[model samples]
Target: MRGSNSSLSSLSRRQPWKLINIADLPDAVLIEVVCRLSCSKLIFRCKCVCKRWLTLISDPYFVDHYLRHQSDKKRHIIRTLIYAREYVVRLRFHPWTNPTVVATYNDLMLCYGNLNRYCICNPCTMQWVALPRIPTYTVHRRSEVRVGFICDTPCYNYKEDEHEDQKGDVMQHNAAYRCKVVRIRPPEKGYYHFSFEWKVDIFSSETGEWRKAVVLSPRAITLNGLGFPHQGILYWLGREENGCSIIFGLDPFSDKPKCFFIALDEPLNDLRHFGVCGGCIRMCGLDMATRSLIVFYLKTEEDGKLCLSKRMVYSLDQNMYLDNESNVSLRPFDPNDEDVCYIYVYGECVRYKYNFRTRKWSTIVEEIPHQISYSFVHVQPWWPTPVPRLPQRACPAESN
Candidate 1:
């Protein structure tokens, strides 16, 4: 028996090893392999390999799995809307580079301000639809219009996946259709005095109609900053008549929508920015006189009311050379990372990033470009959002 085992081992060593074919792997294993691939390779090369692969890659379930995998691996990238030339060329869609992107949600961009142009487009799918002009408001500099966008669809659950065939199949989203765009305009001033009301024009993708709503505030509010969407609610940063900073939040999906105000912490500085960071609404401000950065996080109480709490304060590193005269302001917050923050110094034309974990500051970019849009859109290439096609309506001018 020992001699036979030795002979078998010798024969095994002499024989060449056989390679395992990826096609022979199980569906779960194959999914894991595909999820690890880069977005470009998965979209361009993997999809073209076979019909099964094409169907798998395009399945909504697989997309969700891929996104989770990416997040687990901490793989994310920041990109500008203007830098989508390769995607535009590959998809054969005409690029619209002139309009400035006002809001980005679920990888879709709401671009405004190119000869009064407004549209929503998905860069990955290369699909776009032009929205009708604002009902009655004329474009002007001092108008201070705030725009917010939301595009949410229910994801496939694990229970639903268990019933599918061994070979993966695309799951249909039967009850998932929610997309909205809102334009918040300050109250129209009367000839004699100011009105303490605001006008909100809401556009629904289901109906393709622009409905107007009135938002009332106790004190006069000025919508000065960008509109950020968090947890199905859109928030606008503004100040009151007494120069106290406050946040106004509205739920577009509510049956009876009303603006809810959440007052910020005291001693608020003028140079502050709010955005979704660490899965919450975070606002950061820079104190010019003290060279200190204050960070505040929005939280919810048991009573279902929103409130802001001061998290921590970080003093600006002396090596940064930030002086009292420096025109400094908080830049757009990075949504994927909670440890990193960006601040823009207008006087020096440079952008710096601060690490909260280490409490260190470093320069990210020097000599900021004038043409670039500061409101950047974060996109995950592997997960492409489809732009819904709605019934086309003529522009107001055309109807006239």
Candidate 2:
């Protein structure tokens, strides 16, 4: 028996550790595995695991990764509901039929609807909630609207001596996040009277109240399209006095709305859609003739100045914009996709995928349903609510 036991011990010592199957791994290991996958796949498979896994995958970092991956794939679609006349109009990817009207928000369809009401729907969960009634005071005269999240500022200091004690722990946590609503009210009375006064109001979900931010100056009156919020910043396309269009970025945490001028190679007349692409800002505009589409990259110069660099211009069919008198809506289908962007014409939507190497714009989707509006919503990653990291402790003065 001793001889046999000795032999078995020796065999065990010589054998390598058995490879761990994904099914047999611990929760942490499994989570790491899921994190490495693409966002869509991660979201699809995350629920298969237990509730704990669901919670972990919702982390903001995971959300960031998922959004980034989706953008990279050029698969992100903007949902808009248009409410006009008496019928509700919904626009999506399908070209044969009208896009489905899902929900509404801030007197606008969350998907695609008319002017009086809008819907707010969660696409992934296939759920939606109706927004409050559109205030009659400003519903008719307003030109543009937007929604965003707002959170209370986190305390920057908590401890002095424990700075290095929980560095890893702090890095893993997510800071507090909240949602806020923004509305851009313009002064344009049907007539040629151009009242440049514009006001921005913010609705905080946590406070359940609406507070007015600083009113934009008349000289800052070149805002064309709706505002888009990403990475805690709200962005909009604005035209300068010289008729050149640029993008303006506003930090919700700050008091004044600062301008981040996007430098384009050529001058554009009307700017429409602005979105997040590969962690950078992207702006789309219509050419002077309205038959072509122009894209600008929101980049920073060597001096760290933010500017818009002209990326490319895509021309559609000759008569595409011949009779269309309204402005064009150009948005990025996938926030992660840097090569392709989607444009909304009068009755149809087209996708413009750019190949930087070839310097060409390939039309992907020729005909899509014409919806009134579209907005990009984000799905946060599974993780615990993040606590703000305490500021680094000031080091004691070094002795001379």
Candidate 3:
């Protein structure tokens, strides 16, 4: 018996070393290898793998890493809508061969269309979640609804990861972290005596139910705008008591909403859009008489007063226009560091970069066939990383 055992051990030791294929590696080892790959390539290839690998790669941590790497490697592309006299069209930057309608926030892209009607897709993992229909309201015989996501208050415990060995508590805390959807709509035209009364309905993702309708304040109602949730608050561009446009920040954690006025001393003409830009809320207005684009930079003082510090004007001729009493022509790619201003010129759906140092602008990518859209969210590519995906495929079945 001892001689047989010795012979067996000798045979095992003599066996040639075996090579392990990447696909055969354990979950933890595979994840580490995946971290080294290009985000787009890794995502595209991983789909053909087994289900367990799919689930592991789809975790939020991997998604976050992939996004961070993508942003670090390239300028984030922004989606925009360009309105022509006859048609409203969609455009994207860094055109993809198979571009699908996607909902976009800061850096994250959700599938576009009705929240209840679309599929939520995570491009990085090619994973999707189907969601039920989102509620809506009608205005002027047409249902006008805007849907957005808001992070749940009392943020999930971040420290649990430090003590992963304590599994029970960590799992409990993670399960409690949740998010909700906020829907905004104006009341039907004839239903309310006041035309400005708007109803805000919130749907909790955790509970999957709509909350009671909450009437907005007079100022918030009149604006009839959607809020951009950032840093635990929902911010909207609103008109103040004096009728000047300003940014209002709403912290759902508190009972009363906090307001910040973007005090542009100059008169605003035909204000069209408001959004968060470069960590501050920004409003864009068009000077109709001159066909010039005006962007205002807002600041908050120690005394809590809001002030508009910088005014930039871009004329149709593609030149930068400084704020002067005299009519100014716009300049292309002119950047003002003091005002934290960066100007991106659009030509044939391609965005060119203009460095303040060179005082010159050049095309980043030439001859790209995709139409590109420019919006405030495009300015900061890192902001939309967590945007949720739609629930269903937006295109028709036959088309897919």
Candidate 4:
């Protein structure tokens, strides 16, 4: 024992090699390692370590590569929604690099930090491109306004697995074309709070001018500022003052808009939401009485343009709901989240998830409810890559 201890002391005193730092790694090697990371929350926090690491992370090529992986992975960490209070916040952090997302279509978002300004950006890649302010306004009860933007992708087949016996089939949405932005404005003097008279102006990249719709739609109020693209067409579900539900559809090829209001088969009582899931229109109804969500897929037929077929009825877990005092509509939104979907952030934050294969439901994220459209900190939507394009950002943000 004495001899072994003496030998160990002599060897310890002999020598020790210098420690290696993560910063010493090559750019390619570091990038490969960092791209696998789930979200930028950690990256932004750790970027303060060294200038070389910062510079490498800022490279557009590396950023693009990472975002490509992010889109494929479908792991969204930042939950970007809207603020009901509409508080105008200043640049608290790096607004350009870590921008605030206002509205989202697919993975692309209408982002702006300060009010009255807007831009389109992919948060996953940290690639931001500025968009011109849409010069239009609508006068609703509070002069409320809504904006519309659409992203085009090449030949995205949304209904790849439709039943074979279906009589009619919706054509594949040709997304390869350039995207267009639309601004809708209701006349200030003539329109009532429930007026259907509205005008739409579209901005296309091919033609740099804003073009007006061929026909003004009576159901334009259904647009509601945001448009959902399904099978290459944009749709907005609306309900008028008299309580009649309407559907507004815009065909990209013809630039023609149409409105239809056929009676719904079922008498809907609770608040409902419409969204595009798997390239088809899906409606989710929040039933506060039983604390259950009724989901239906909208099908088109020769007789009736809008048809609702029951998809699934998901019950909100008592543990997730936690509050029995209020039967107020939770307003379930953003069905894109896979493990769970975000319901309204009212007095309490409520969220749930459904499995398509198993048709199972689970409570994933729940927190104290905040303002409207505001996403929580850890549970954020992974912004997807709309298409493959190099971003031209307003602030050549430090990804030098």
Candidate 5:
């Protein structure tokens, strides 16, 4: 019996019990398991588990595959985190500090501090990269300089056979969308003084450099606040010199900037806003006579021209809280679910939420405007699209 017991003890010592031998698992299965993790930081740490795991995690092919899968499954969720509030569950431990918004694309957010500092962060992982100084333009008053963050539009996720170029295309293509910061400045003397010309600057992670260009726009358009990007084009709410509110579409990949009529009737009012939904640009307007808010979906054909169609109309229940000039926008919950969106009604000292799914209306918190400088965290799964790196720096205010 002593001999038998000794043999058993030796066997147990030689191979202790493990929950499961991850190393023994098939490489494909192990990768799938790692891809299911909720937090990338955790996955990153898991890479140190073993050499095989490390090789799989570090491979560009695996990274691109994972990103494409996550993006395709639409497994992530986007929840706006108001930075001002304390005691957020789980995230309370991270140091959000005084986060000022600069730009947003997918789950990535670029922000700057009150000083001329900058950072690119993913709230989901609380992982951030501090970036070096932008090559062109310095922080200035809101009237002079404006900054926006955008990435190349994501491609449709589809399964393809493994090949060198296949991996390269997916990895290189996805890495391109890592994040690009755009800084626009009006020439101090002329453009800032209604010269209508603005300087465009871009910082690309691929090249890790900033390039500057000038848009010698003769037409006037609203150049205030953040701009929107879609299908490789960036959009902003602006008005023509004739006082007609128009939507200006800027192709970041090109120098051509054009303006399109936002409303059927000329809307010179400043209470208008726009958002991207269902791959279309939605614009807000007011029917001056009826005082009802009108929303239109502007669709662009392959030829690059835009056509507008009235999508929905919302009538105010209580005019006291709602005004003819209320800022209205529709934020789609997910690209996969196009039928649903959240209507954000701002201005008039009142804030409310309108649900398009059930056509229900309710007043949400009023401090949302203050919470504007926040980030969206969607824990849902997304298809793999490899991303790049950036860091935070001390700079002026950033946009989202």
Candidate 6:
């Protein structure tokens, strides 16, 4: 028995241990395994494993599955992207000339460049598609124009190929095939006097075409700034002919598409900022008379009517903006935390962060170039969204 045991031990020691190679696994299994990895590991580590891994990671189908899986695990984390003069250093790729982020939805960013140029980008994967040139709209030069971006589908648990066999233009029913860019142009020079409808031009990725539409307003209103999307709806801050402030919303994906407006208690102020926070639309404005910051949340009642409800008020130092020549504007609020806010002192070229929980303001960034405006969009960082494919090959984004 001792002689037999010794012989077995010797045999086991001499034999090489069998190892399992992850790359040898089936594609489906491989996807299932890699989808669980963190975005950093998957992008920086697994993608470097081999050509197959890089290809799999870049696949749209795989990206969709990974996003759904992450959503199921509730692993998404909001990241604020500040695209200032130094943004070029952080973003490795730069395809557009003088690109500025105009809008963001989920993980996609819509960047606008000089001469009516626009492009959609997935910054994490360094993928971007230059959209077709936007056509000129015949509106008054003084009319304010607003642009927005949105996805027709939900952000999670959605399969791009679910309705592949639906026997028609699959793009119509498949949410994955729809991404829209909307341009709101004010009424022509003399048209606003008789009509409340504003001319709207919509560009759809599936059709690669721009279509004309109109949104009716309760009264003639002027869009204040670039709008932001929340819950698949784009909302803009606007002022009416009577000087009353209003929130204009457009539901382009609804079965019956329509535009609606909500009245605000106060008139539109240059220092007012609008954004989405804590899964709700919130607005922060500097109350110059009171030397305080007032926050408002958009709430819907049982009757289905929407209204702004006062959420909080924070007193500001009287001396902070005593310089009458200073242009003090409330910066875009952080989407993740309702208590954290930013204020930009344009004249001083400084941005300060105020924490309502702590009631303190600290300098976040200073000495910003006056020419470089603060235009940014929020995205979920851990989820690396792939760029939507177009019929034409997308141009590669290059780094400076």
What TM-score do all the candidates reach, one by one? 0.73, 0.51, 0.53, 0.57, 0.68, 0.73
Q: Quick one: best lDDT, which candidate?
A: 6
Q: Which stretches of candidate 2 lie over 4 Å from their true place?
A: 1-175, 188-196, 205-208, 218-222, 230-232, 240-246, 256-270, 274-280, 288-293, 300-305, 309-336, 342-356, 361-367, 375-400
lDDT by residue for model 3 (312-339), tens: 6655434433334233222222112323
- Put down candidate 5 lDDT per residue, 87-159, tens digits, no spaces: 2443332355565555666666566643455566665545565566654345565435566677766633335
| lDDT of each residue in 148-244, candidate 4, tens digit only | 5665663233333366874333333332456666555555543335554666666564553456664455443433434555554566545555554
- From the highest TM-score down, the ranking of the candidates is 6, 1, 5, 4, 3, 2
Worst 10 residues of 5 by lDDT: 391-400
Clashing pairs in 6: 94-398
The TM-score that candidate 6 achieves is 0.73
Could you tell me the TM-score of candidate 3? 0.53
Please identify which of the two predictions, 2 or 4, would achieve the higher lDDT against the true structure. 4
All candidates' lDDT scores? Answer: 0.64, 0.47, 0.44, 0.52, 0.56, 0.66
Report the poorest 10 consecutive residues by lDDT, candidate 2: 391-400
Q: The CA-based lDDT of model 1 is what? A: 0.64
Better of 1 and 6 by TM-score: 6
> Model 2, 1-400: lDDT tens per residue?
9999998899989995698766677755765567556444446566667766677666545554444444445653433322332232223322213333332222222332345443344333433333333456656533344333333432121222345663322222224434445665554542122334555665443443455665544353356555665445566666656665555555555456443444343556456554455555666667756466666666555554465554766666553433664645554454444565555554444444554335565666644445544443333332222311221221112100
Q: Candidate 1 clash total?
A: 0
Clashes of each: 0, 53, 20, 16, 46, 1
Q: Summing lDDT over every window of 10 consecutive residues in candidate 3, give the lowest-scoring window.
A: 82-91
Model 1 CA RMSD to the hidden true structure, in angstroms: 6.6
**Deviation from truth (RMSD, Å), model 4:** 9.5
